[model samples]
Target: MTHQTADATDHPTVAALVARSNRLGGDPRNTNYAGGNTSAKGTAPDPVTGQDIELLWVKGSGGDLGTLQPKGLAVLRLDRMRALADVYPGLDREDEMVAAFDYCLHGKGGAAPSIDTAMHGLVDAPHVDHLHPDSGIALATAADGEALTREIFGDQVVWVPWRRPGFQLGLDIAAIKAKNPQAIGCILGGHGITAWGDTSEECEERSLDIIRRAEDFIVSRAASRDAHPFGPQRPGYEPLPDDERRARAAALAPVIRGLASFDAPQVGHFTDSSVVLDFLARERLLPLAELGTSCPDHFLRTKVKPLVVDVPTSATVEETVTALRAAHAAYRADYAAYYERGAAAARARGEEPPAMRGADPTIVLVPGVGMFSYGRNKQTARVAGEFYVNAINVMRGAETISTYAPIAEDEKFRIEYWALEEAKLQRMPAPKPLAMRVALVTGAASGIGKAIATRLAAEGACVVVADLDLAKATAAAAELGSADVAIGIAMDVSSEAAVQAGLREAVLAFGGVDLVVNNAGLSLSRSLFETTEADWDLQHNVMAKGSFLVSREAARVLVDQGLGGDIVYISSKNSVFAGPNNIAYSATKADQAHQVRLLAAELGEHGIRVNGVNPDGVVRGSGIFASGWGANRAAVYGVPEEKLGEFYAQRTLLKREVLPENVAAAVFALCSSDFSHTTGLHVPVDAGVAAAFLR
Candidate 1:
């Protein structure tokens, strides 16, 4: 990686471009300089670009992007790039410039495109970027980067071996893009790649995505092979002195936020608990999992790693967390101290953290100590920090074989920062294949929603009941409790935050999230004219918008877990076939059905299936259904309670008003592996209302 050279007149611009390249801001941050180069080819197109969709301008290569000048940007005719790709099907390092040139860039109008132009010309994105980041390098070193990439990103991204730069890489980009018109880019293993998007920001976002994925993969591998810390399966803990507990919490709180995640309460509680304390204090409770981060993208979900600390019972949670609170800050302070101390200690010593200093730490395994990471996002924190408690145990058994040594810091950083490597993270949005195996149900209270949730739970899923009625969700959970069954969450589906919070807790509790039943809904029997707007909104908010919020978050978790998921919308027959003069009740349910269809397409690649069920009038009694059918029908049709069943049932071919339990059965079917491929379609519970009517 030598520095770029520049012509005298282009010195200033070249310097600026060189600086930009070296800053290492976006994708390929830590591992770039050779993957891809930017060269502005010609002037802007005649049309003005729209907002949020800027024409991310790239200067063509005069010298190189590493030291490109405004003039260095060839502004060449893009036509050449396009033509070149079409002509050169077998481009490679040996291809002559003119011979490969025709095969690389083509004429858009009559203009000659840049040599690396095919990539810039053909991509259908607003922004196109090419980089070789550091993390990619680390990932590639293991020789399993490709498999790992496919596992995490699904089918959105493409991974290719390193090809020679210039025309060869350019042709490869065009070929891949032609086949996957919707593709972002591909990883150029040893070389680099060219990526495109609808906009520059989008391009940057995609770049970030690639690096993160690569980082996550490599880190995971490093952790798996190396033995650093050995911790227990269950965190060991015991009561700690109050002073120590509070002290630990206070000390670790801020660092935890930066390195673990937002859930301070859970972290503090877990750390302070007797179980965790005992585990941390145990001399042998080394790193359980030397968690290498998935990638910088995972940074958003998991900080770096957990501080797997082992402390004596005397060391309260507060004391330990609190004491460690100053650790990060102290570390930062120490970096400066080390830098200054080095000035006095020795000039040759690198003044930086061990990680940055080119010293690959197999994590500092303090015998009785717990694990930790550099940032928040605790999920990753635990992964990053746990020095593979497993590795520790294995090593203990293998002490006779040989001691372990962490990879070198420079190598680690090289892998961490490589660009050609990070492109894997920027892959497309699709569901991982893993999520299909698991399912979760909530509001297993009773009636329609409960029936659906419970059904899934019974089908070998680790069912967890979540509802506003904690007792009810709990009772339902208890009744179904088994090897795979779990507990209940007292959540009010009506509240946006509550639903999200509950679902998140479930995701963390369970390793992943797959099926979500947006089944908790209520129907008020007030007639059309009598319903207030507020009442209508309340109903819609829960039945419609609530589902929206829940499905959105659920999809994210599902995608992250690299597993497919399912969402079942429980509707009423009233949604499609008009029921009386009722407006609010029917309208909201209809909205629910529509929403399901739309989300199905959006989440399809993620393998998240969305479907709807329109159950008929469910018979109710004095229990959870006290107000189930309160008067709307009796008021409109002026029908007596005695003849309601006869009136409603007579309309159906089966002559039966669908029961709450029956609706639940439909929901259960829609959400399980039974309907793994079904989505975007709505099924009616009304026996033959629509089916019987050939008219």
Candidate 2:
């Protein structure tokens, strides 16, 4: 490829690079999410020298190419970056070179330069791209990849043997390019592919061309083969019907999540996509999954391998769950040994290995159900699943054309425990207090429930806003965050069937339940003589009975997860204080208050904590009060409806009005680490109402 002169305007060159990157990344067939980098070189005026200087702009660390912005690009002086080659230490010290990139930065350098910055800067091309497209990786990981590369594109594409990515790999690619000027790109052994061109358009085209050709080669060869790449589908391993699979997944998600969170709590993602189902049903699933994923991007998120449960689709949920526990224990033991072997290998080479990561597997596959991937948050978990699917595609293609041969186990261990990778993990911001936890708040569409949901989402928990009105709940969920962070579902707590269905939706959305807020209620202000049996029943059903049902249903999931969880009841101060013309409301609240204590006592053995928040007279922005409760209470107390809030506030010791936000804050506190050890306790958000104080 001939070198093109630097563009006169640097902006257009970078703009074109970003455009090309987005095109490649937006398509899943081009590359897995955030698994590729693109670069462009141009001429820019130096701030200090007032002269034209060559600069390299590349996608920075921790950014997805599909959503790359100008600010996400790291700009470096190409001359300064190339100069590092003179003092570059041997491959053993390649990590030190990453730190040296900072010194070569131009201006603010935008985002942090990634390790692949060297590959972009030293490639000696105006435009460069390195991608992990499934088709390209299929050929790269094939046993005869070098021969296939020669056969696929003849001499147009070259083959680079397996080498760990760093400064040395960059130098090696540059040398390959210099030696074969006529070569368009190279298939990186046990990795992906690299392509370059004199211009951005040409580079992108070459990349797509390589990917298309590799895909065609595999497809054509597969057509000639007699057997399926993954072998025949096992007799009892076929996927269940869509509805059955989802229901089974809902039941097992908590158990798998609990086991995966042995080291730390994790959010989970469940997928029954075609790729996952096809792979799971195949007879070769166990052996191929055990061999682990080939791509570095794949294993880093999915872990070295997945845990494949052997239970058949016809097995009962209870029996399947029992098998899962035994399998999980064995998986942990094997991972421990794998870590020791890798550490020993490092020691033998006179290198101190980084501490092993969590021993629990991030991915779980069941033949009848689907794939479940876990991570510290919902987005991470979902992305991990997507990467595993990409790995599946790679395996399917590789096995079709030739034997799927990944890098050595020691190499996988080396990359998995790299010091640089550990540094990236350490640099991540501290997680929010509610991070990795999932909360389902009943009646979260408005008032106290909505406030609580908002606060929980802000603190980093995935929230499910459950209300009788699906539209309102959906609107509230939208306000909170994206689907990954929050979702909405309809629930009529008065019905046990509805309660169970709502909980199932919550689990499907975010793995399992960690926090349950029983806040759904209706208030009827009436004296004992005026209260009808119907009114009493309605109040009790929505408040007392409803709380019990929600707790009972959620408790099953919590216990199954085996991770300690919190259950909060939104009881009222009226539960302790006797208020006139409020017989039914007060009695229901009192029932809720006692139920909290009883549940706390019963569930403590399972590490589930039940607590309550007693809020007095939340008139403003309150659904219960706005639905005629405020006017009814006002008439009973000989006060105007507008003055009801003031009347309630004046009676309190502090004389301050209690708002919905105050109640939400109390709920947050009860569910926070500060109250981890304090169960069966109710904190009053009643502005110091002495009458409601706990005896």
Candidate 3:
């Protein structure tokens, strides 16, 4: 793998490596999460000696190579790292290896080097890139992988059997490369493939070339014996129609979501993309999908084998969910046995037995329906979903060429429970209280509703921005974050049909609703003597009636799903203390405050917590003010309209203007586990107004 050229400049070399690494990183079929790493060797002046020393700039730990930056590549003295081969022979623990890697650091580069730094250092080429391409992994993990490698690549590639990644593994790779000096790169069985050359472009070309060969091999074989598109089917079996299959999937979605979540605040979302449904439609789906990860790199995310739910032919949706529940139980029991088998094997080999991970399956495959990926958050779930697609492609390719044989179960367990890999999982950030929980925020386009939606999203909830103005709602959702994080829809809460339809859309998008903020309202400030019948109806229709409709519809979805949820109404300080020229606004708010109490009493038995946030003086960009309520209120107080915000800020005991964010904070507190056991509570966010405090 060694090459040196006088024409090579550091700028082009680094640029080429970064570009190639990003291309691979961006494609899930090539790599996932942070699974693969890339490196390029160049000469640098030693700071102290001022001597030219060769350094390996490799992808660092915990950063995705797809978005790799120059700083993300740790610089290590290649000569010093390669020398660790002698030291590795005597080391038995990972800590010692890590210490040796640290000692090899060439500069004050603060990036934590990947554990594979030593392995990359051993590659004989200046530009090296390792990838876990689905095709490469498919051929690498098969039972006859060595023979296939010899047949397909001939003497171009060196084949090394699986060795737990560490100092010893790096040493083994170095030894193989030394023996096969002219070989392009080596294929690490049950792992991944690597390619190296004088230029980053050459290395990338070589790696992709090998991947294409494997892909071609599979295509050729499948084409020659192309008898069944659905793979080998069971005797006398026929797959259900696509529409029927999808119908079953939709029916089972809520139940699958429930099973994926924990009793705590955690919730796991599910997705059944096209590839998943296509895979589920395959013949002999259970055995093929159960072959485990295509390579060891996938173990950290998808687990050893997906949970397969057997959907018997001619089964109804109810029967399907019942079967899924029972299958989940059996899956847990099987996982226990699998863990025990691996632990005993480790003990026999005189290695420290690793602790068992959670029994919940990250990937779920249901026959006659579709696959389900469960993760604490949507991104992780999508990763699982993406890798599962990779696995299917790998398996299908391998099955077409020969009998599909992934690494043994024991090998899968070793990687799944490896301490370093476990550390990666442990380093994931602690989840926010509302992580993955979906909330519907009415009037989220602006004002207090917008603040509440933003806060909820920051705490990890996916917010649906429901407002009367479709454009504003859409724009607000976009401003908050990605569509996955926040979506928007038009909902005139006063209309019963519109409220019901809006709630339905929310449920459709997020599986089911967990929280609702009835914050959409307007102020009609006409005095009782001058107020028309329309003024009273308009205010009541939006505030009081609107609150009832949204609550009833959202509560129906929550209760039907049997998942305890929260509902909050945006009442006002006027509800507790009426003000001059505010009859219509004050009376309607007061009515809803009482409604909150009544609904809380009724919904409590069903684990639905109903509460209210009463905020005053949120005058900046207030919809009420924009609708002409502020000028009238200022005139009543004999103050100019422009001074209203300041006047209200000075009136509070804290002398802090009550912003919508303040009200949002209170609403978040009520909706979170902090108030899990407390409901029917009206929290004020007016900065200590004596008149507005609840009795």
Candidate 4:
């Protein structure tokens, strides 16, 4: 897709539109992570006809307004779109309309236009901004939302009742505009706000000003009254003490995440941010919080209503999990019933309802703790969390001003199953293999561990970089990518206490572990006669003892979470193909080889698989080489240390250099379902080393 430069040198209209769109997109109060759309209409050179034609530059589907560039906006011939609207005048045939939208594209290398293009095109203005603003939706979805809008803005804005957004909504907008020519904007009931102006700045300023007015109305009323926002007003409940609330949230996150994973193997992410915590702390508002989302636009992200569970006041993990699982089952059953009811209502109205969506609750509300959001991946979870936060804010504001009310149940169903939203979802890429799973890699500061961690994160798994050096681990995690994808922690695997504490920290940070890579090791090339006791002790502690400690601790968590998991050890080829002067390293690796088999036998019943990878002559970026063991290894082979990598590569049957990435690939394969049926097996990533082949 072509990206428009944010340069001010473009046509004044495009430049102004880009500037204002970016400004609105940048602020969460206006737009969330790519949640809103912006557009501008102006005359542009028509390629087909040597004439200036009215064209609409609108935010493309999936484009983030905050970082929008010129290429991010699709340009369409307004005359063509307006005419197409007349062709399908009475009702919306969604697929046909979307295809027609694609056929009207006038810009080169632009992404797909947003489904809301019709509404923007129908609004006769130089600039239009449509956003799911919290304050705006608060006033739009209130019990007396129309009255509130009239009282707050009077004829300044028009109220458009809830309609599934499509060609029909565009027609309604046009009709509304024709009657209320002086209105600056229109509030879509249980949806969002759409504002227009003769110029880009005027439209943007008007939108912001309207939102500010709503904010003021809510705040002023809240300060005047002691009653809850939603009535039959209940007495205000004091918040839980900070320490107890934090402790409760921490203890309950894993259980909630685990329960959310009911049928899935991967536990989802959690959002215990201060906003969520404060909302949860208000014990009296728990009932209202379970009502539903603030606006219908949030339906796709958070479902109809969050599944509410009892506050884990002083509960144990086992107790919480049991309660949560029961609550989750009940929630799913209720969701199924709710859908059936909506479907029956649609049929009773003589309208065929769309297909049913998944019954799982995306947002889970725990009264005493905090809210938790679930998604197939981290980004989805974050986006859902953001929408829920906005919902909470809007609900609070509306309640403080007047009784809070979302759209009716039937409208929720229509919005949640809107064909336009479904089409957008259909365009998304299929999820990767490691999506949503969490992996922990010890000694991830560099080499094989680093490669494994990076690969896992790239494949969509959240990674934990555990290393003895916190600084190096932190830097390494940063390099892997976003903080949501990976985190770095300090841990010396050889220390039992450190390993235990590190696992606890990891569990709290990422919900629970689904995969563990036991890769920490120390190398020494001392012959049996020359091997020192210290060398033997150190090698065994890190390689054998360390892997065991990590494996045992990780197993405990996986068992507790009750989700099947994978554990892979990065043992050495030396364990299978012993060479001269490698006594300490070889023996410890052999110990790990046997350890993997024994642990696999023990963990199989718990649904935890154990495996190992034996990598030979990964000398190029070997931590062993960095520690000066390459010279000692080269001395044994009668070659220069610098040539050892080449020597090993040439000696292998494949004559290929076995890099750290190759070993990481093997670890990933063993961890994934590719080798799911087999455990206690050690795969060799040594470019086909004949001597290292297991018998």
Candidate 5:
């Protein structure tokens, strides 16, 4: 059969390829995020030669197909890529082939070529797609996968037995296609599915057809078997009520995350989604989870396997925490052993093993609550959870038809420590200083609090924008980034219940808090004679009492995590400097200033640092000012409301207004490693207030 190929002006060819990739990637049933590649073989004109040259445009390395753009496509000269076969070495040296892809670039390639480049270029088709759809992997990992492939699709789709992905595997698939001219795709044993077609439309349709058929086949097979593929729910492992389960998860997240961060600090994601809950409650949960995931994409993010917490749904949070601590220790030991075994095997085979990445499991499974996945950042943690869910689906489908069999342990190790993968990791950008740290900033909806949150997020910290106004806080969080980077929660810091609930939400959102900024407060300026009981109480309750409550609750979690943290109180210059008609506010500010020193002394044993930032009268963009404090302060100072900032600036030694960002910068500096050894310190952002300066 002759295939019509697109020529130089066929830009639509690549566009259609991208569109098809996005469609397939958009659905979880088709492929997990960043787990697949799509390519179109077309022709583009060589600028110098003015001749149409055959080229291959494939999804590049480390990119998600769902969000693929033209620039994310790696362009390669088809002829040069095909020529790689001439000097190709054996499987032992297959990794070298990746380097050769650079030499096959068509001009400056738009993006780096991925490991699967050969699989697409070598295949004799204009369009090809390699996907990790759950249903397809289910068929791939089944014990009788090859026979099932024949039985299900006859000759339309063939089975290619397991071979670690590389140049050889690509050659193997190409050979199979040559032999089976009628074949449109193949199920890669212990891996995934790859489909090819004469046209882009045909390729996408064929890929979807394979996935649909595989899913239907699993459903049909399951109809004759027990409804629960993973076995009936274990007697004591049923899911708790939604509220209780979440509360338990929130309580447990910090402990699990801290343990997971034994080697390096990690951000975490929690899920009580139906699939995760169902899997956790099953009788076969332990055995299947122990067997680990089959697909390389699944294990790379989730680690070889997850650490499962053995506890009943009715177990108390304290009891579960005890169990988790013990489980984590054992998991670390087992992981070390696994690494040694793999390293020994590599040495025997005359290949030096790569250094161990980390002993901590990236994923943790609790019988009653849910799964907690951890990584260097929130997105990685979330993706790891998603990949594990895909693995669970694969296991369920595989069990429906036949015994589920993942690749051998040694094989998993080989891929896990693959030199190419290590190189890819090395190429990643250095992490930001605050990466993996979670911060909860009260009053973060606006003003100095929002500025601090923004700065922390910019430095790579996961931020929880906590405020009494949930909507404004949420909006602020959204402006900062996605849920992985920031989340907003309603937090009335003055209320103990609200503070506890808000911190719980923060823990659930990003494992635990490493930084807490007590920036929530209201200001009241009144003469001693005119200050009412209500004014005094409101000021004290919101600032002095609020800071204490937030600090106390956050300290409990910080100590429980056993991870050192920082708590910075946003005080005021009036804390030290005597100011007229500011009795109530100044007293509360003094209370906050003292709390910092007191907590710093108490929490030092736990490595928790407490500090404070004092700013002079901030008028512009100040929430307190906007709410009427500016006019009150201006009147007391005998200056116009608009001149309040300038008035304060002129009085300062630096003669510069202290904006919200200036206060934010001081907060950041205090929480940063720069101030690691200097706690109980008050940094004034009030230009140069000699009276307020620390003596």
Candidate 6:
């Protein structure tokens, strides 16, 4: 995607962009496996002349900045950016959230803005360039990282303690910009640095200088260390003679390919790191809480901590590696579960999914294991190891100091997935109809609403449960509670006026809304064919009209917020599969499903995701299969209702009936990331009963 022709000269401005990125560096090594991207402000079209504003040449996605080109840059209207930022707070969740990816936001059309785009936005410089510089990251992740920032940039740089990178961080910057006009650059605590100047060269100069200084600090600090910072492995730290440290590196070199490359008589391979380890081996070292190493970006080389994976050298190399692989899988799965739970909690609260990865899978802390800085290449891996080695040392050293608290779960998400993360890897999928955004569920009191709400919640959506039956919604909410779990509100999901009031209150609680599960239908009507119109009207008003009214109000909030949301109708399977009873129920179910498709097409353009879940002949549940379903089965199978489930349990090919909980889990699956790409699709949750594959 090379965009600009080389003028056969070094663009000083581009050089400065590159230089600025290197300033906070330990190593200006090309850290991102994908390289770097620099964006100069593009020219806007003269409205009357109809001329296009020229965009700065930035490296396109997958194009690293180590060797950059103009095609990598996305040409965009610098002026329209604020509006774009305000409109799309959760844009960071996109697989690729670059201004260049879509023509609509940040002028990125198919090309994304840098992963650090938002941080760059904070500077307000005409040009912004981001790179994975070793020195800057190392300095940022250090124990006394803030003091380092003060030592180098002084008052000129706005120092932000390590926080998750995301919309809120962007919002914070926007707020900070208002207060301090002179501040141009900022250091993200536990992250990296941002430098900006009126001219790209000036900014570049400042950034490069900063990196060199930070790198020097790293070198000197390593010299001051008495022992290996990570402490001694296998416990009971023994004082290692200096010569023994070099001997150890020598002995370990063959196993780890890269350490030997940097080995030298004057500066032995990993000597400084060795010193830090010896220190760590000491019994009284840095407390575990003080340790902070999450990324190669946060600290040039060590993305994760130096994991002292307790594997035996005695084991075959392949066997050891296999164990490591298994451990890694378990760690990832556990982390993913954590992510799903937290994300689901937020979804229940009726908000957009957190911008940062819920799991923070990026940084894994194995208590006694070596570290991992997942880079595109080995150089990146080795460089990251350098800082991780030191930081663990500092953390151990800091045991004398007060405990260091890492950023909170809410805060971590702010940075890792911040809207401005430098564009690097794959572009986020074009905004799916639903996306894995968050949605709130109301009328999640029990039965259908609970099932639908639970389903959506499980889909990794952050959901909220609101119902007149607060006890029930609360219980439901209890099931979903995690780090950032969903909230339970007491009220009706209906009542045009109540809906308005509840939504207003709920929206104020969370930032906004995305999806509304209109599951608050009530039924006192016994039978339509056997009963009167008054009975029917009551059912229609509460069940049918209530959903319509709620949908209208919910849509207003969704559309007004400008974040397209989803609306799932918990229509029953009776809509299509009729039974002798439930005449009124069947009519409402049919209407609910029919309404879903219409709503989907209408809101499609608004970026809203809407769908329906229809479950038929669902048996209520106390346990896996205890009571409510038995009577239904007993009657259907012509046996005593108690023996009914026994008859039907083997009826399906899978030998199961759709438990109410099964329906609930199904609903969640459909709305979560598993089914994010699917909308306007009616998902049936009747367990094979609908298919009749079983004899």
Best by TM-score: 5
Q: What is the TM-score of each candidate against the true structure?
A: 0.42, 0.97, 0.89, 0.92, 0.98, 0.42
Per-residue lDDT over 1-695 for candidate 2, one digit per residue giving the tens place of the 0 to 100 score: 23322322247887798899999999999998889899999887776666778899999998898988888889898999999999998887889999999999987788899988999999989999999999999999999999999999998899999998899989999999999999889999989999999999999999999999999999899889999999999998899998899999999999999999999899999899999999999999999999999888999999999999998899999999999999999999999999999999989988898887788989999997999999999999999999999999999999999989998899999889988889999999999999999999999999999999999999999999999999999999999989999999999999999999999899988899999999999888988999999999999999999999999999999999999899999999999999899999999999999999999999999999999999998999899899999999999999999999999999999999998899889988999999889999988999988878899
Candidate 6: how large is its RMSD? 22.4
Q: Per-residue lDDT tens digits of candidate 5, residues 45-134?
A: 786666778999999999999998888899999999999999999888999999999999887788999999999999999999999999
Tens-place lDDT per residue, model 3, 313-388, is: 4777777778888987887788889999998987887777657766767777776555667666666666676777
lDDT tens digits, residues 1-695, model 1?
A: 23222222344433443344434332224332222454322233232231111122344432333444344443333444455455554532223443444333211222222334545655544346665454443333224446655675665677765443445655566677778765666765433334555544455556667767765654565457554333333334544465644433433332343222222211111123333344355444443223332222222122222234344445544565554444434444543443344343322432222222211121222112323232112232343333233222222322212222223323233334323223322332343222223344544577666666556655545555877788887777788764234567777777777876676556433334557777767766666677888879888887787778777767766664434567878766777777666688788888988898899889898777889887666655312234646455655567776566566678788888766667767766776556778999787787768632322
Candidate 4 C-alpha lDDT tens digits along 8-46:
238677787889988998888886677778898887665
Give the count of colliding residue pairs in each prediction.
Answer: 156, 0, 2, 7, 0, 113
lDDT of 4 at 494: 95
Alpha carbon lDDT at 533, candidate 5: 97
Better of 4 and 6 by lDDT: 4
The predicted structure with the larger TM-score, 3 or 4, is 4
Provide the overall lDDT of each model, using Cα atoms, as 2-decimal numbers.
0.49, 0.92, 0.78, 0.80, 0.92, 0.50
In model 4, pairs of residues that clash are 2-71, 3-71, 4-69, 4-70, 4-71, 229-399, 229-400
Error at 243, model 6, angstroms: 18
Model 4, 324: alpha-carbon shift in Å? 0.8
Question: Which residue window of length 10 is worst by lDDT in model 5?
Answer: 1-10
**How does candidate 2 score on lDDT?**
0.92
Model 1 has an lDDT value of: 0.49
For every candidate structure, what is the RMSD over all alpha carbons to the true structure, in angstroms? 20.6, 3.0, 4.2, 3.3, 2.7, 22.4
Clashing residue pairs for model 2: none
